[model samples]
Target: MDADLPPLTEALVQDVIYAWCSSAKHEITVPNCGAVWGPEADVVSVTRARLGHEFEIKVSRSDWLSELRQIRGDRRCAKWYRAHTLTNAKEEAKKTAGLAAKGSNCCGLVPPSYFWLVTAPGIVRDDELPAYAGLMEVVPYRHGIHQAHGYRVTETRPAPRLHRVKLLDNQLMAMARGVTLRYWQQRRKAA
Candidate 1:
């Protein structure tokens, strides 16, 4: 990490993602939506066409590796899906249970159509990423003589559509309601 760089935190990653998602024309974006999506989601977004995107922020290499070990089954990740789909079903199932039981973050969770991994620069490499997930990095940009003006999110690999189905109306409502509820909760805290 650069000595002058701000500490890489989930909040910084989420802010970068919000800017990136908005620039890409997404209509709705929310952070910390365990009620609407999985607890593993650092940020969730919905496009105007109703496609859902999930961003999981990883600030450290250990945290990133830990995440891969937690989310199991073909439903959540393309890499896991491919690996399992190629193996003996019974044997794979046995192994999956042991690995997946290590965490509850993504167990039995249905993934959004698009999934992304966001990190500070150099935390993860492009080849390490799963096939189903996109990669983005928070990088310093707009350099001045002394330092960068701020950080920006840049996609290293675009995420493939994991599924064609748009989010159902009910799911959209749940997301909307989740944001509304979060807003009020924050307001209440301020009061």
Candidate 2:
């Protein structure tokens, strides 16, 4: 986690994600997830789970891959997903194909059942959009709310697609500090 990130940015990311998850009809659980098995293996600042599904929250491409490398080799980390029934070998194979179709920039984080890329305006350039398309749904952050546009992943894709959304600077920083944005999004809907 980047210690330099602004405190307010971290708060916004956490608040938005929490709100989003809480509003979901399903019984969603945000776990203390991290990546520690791959080459870039490092602690994922914030991760979440719902119905045995897990997702990693990333604000940038570098952060996303760093966490992914950690889980690539460490069976203990990989086992966490299996023990929780979050994913499997068969599903992993399928996710790779799905990500290729979407042109995702992420380094394949066990094929997310759901992936969210929350960024600030002007942060994600136009050319970068196509690279991540279909890979994960984009979640845009604006004002103080985060909304789901539609389902980006499907049986054809299987893996959680990336969602790109613009978030405030404070929110972005909060995510860097390990805040859960799903919770914030859910809270907004409940209100």
Candidate 3:
């Protein structure tokens, strides 16, 4: 873990969620939106299907309200306005509804299917999240990643029912290759 990084528990929770999404073959987008709009908007938007309902993933430890307060601060609040500029709450609600509709149609799910606030253990109490909503609690698990000289390397682990998906920085390079191949394949087919 980097010295400047937030607590290991927090990062671990995020990694677990990332792994879950990866293993499920869902397209994960960071800095998404959720039910609650930030001063900026949402962070970590994950959309899988084309025109599918999207999820806004928020990570918190303790003090969710306090965290929300910080989010309303100048720097963080700027993100919401920067991402969404509809001029009024009505417009924002309309856009949110539209996004939810698209997401539901794409994924064959219903409206307001938001996977909001996956936090570390004990971060959010049962009463914190809404009863009838799609809020989820993601518990963190251990993965064999040894830190050496400011870098971490993942080691082999026992194959469990749910295998953790390991995504390294190099994964982006592989994505580029896949995109290039797809383009050429499509071009050849068309030709």
> How badly does each model clash, as a count of residue pairs?
0, 57, 13
The best-first sequence of candidates by lDDT reads 1, 3, 2
What tens digits encode model 3's per-residue C-alpha lDDT throughout 1-191? 33554454444544544554455465743332232222322323334432222223355554565654444456645533422231232343454455555654322112222324444345555664433223444432234322212222121121111111222223223344445665798899999
The digit string of per-residue lDDT tens for model 2 on 66-150 reads: 5445434355664344323233433553554466457766524343334334433333344443222213223343334334222
RMSD in Å for candidate 3, one decimal?
12.8
Stretches > 4 Å off in candidate 2 = 1-8, 35-110, 130-191
lDDT of each: 0.69, 0.37, 0.37
Q: Please report how far candidate 3 places residue 82 from its true position, in Å.
A: 13
lDDT leader? 1
Please list the residue runs of candidate 3 whose C-alpha ends up more than 4 Å from where it truly belongs after superposition: 1-10, 31-45, 51-61, 68-115, 130-133, 140-191
Q: Which wins on TM-score, candidate 1 or candidate 2?
A: 1
| Model 2 lDDT-worst window of ten | 148-157
Better of 1 and 3 by lDDT: 1
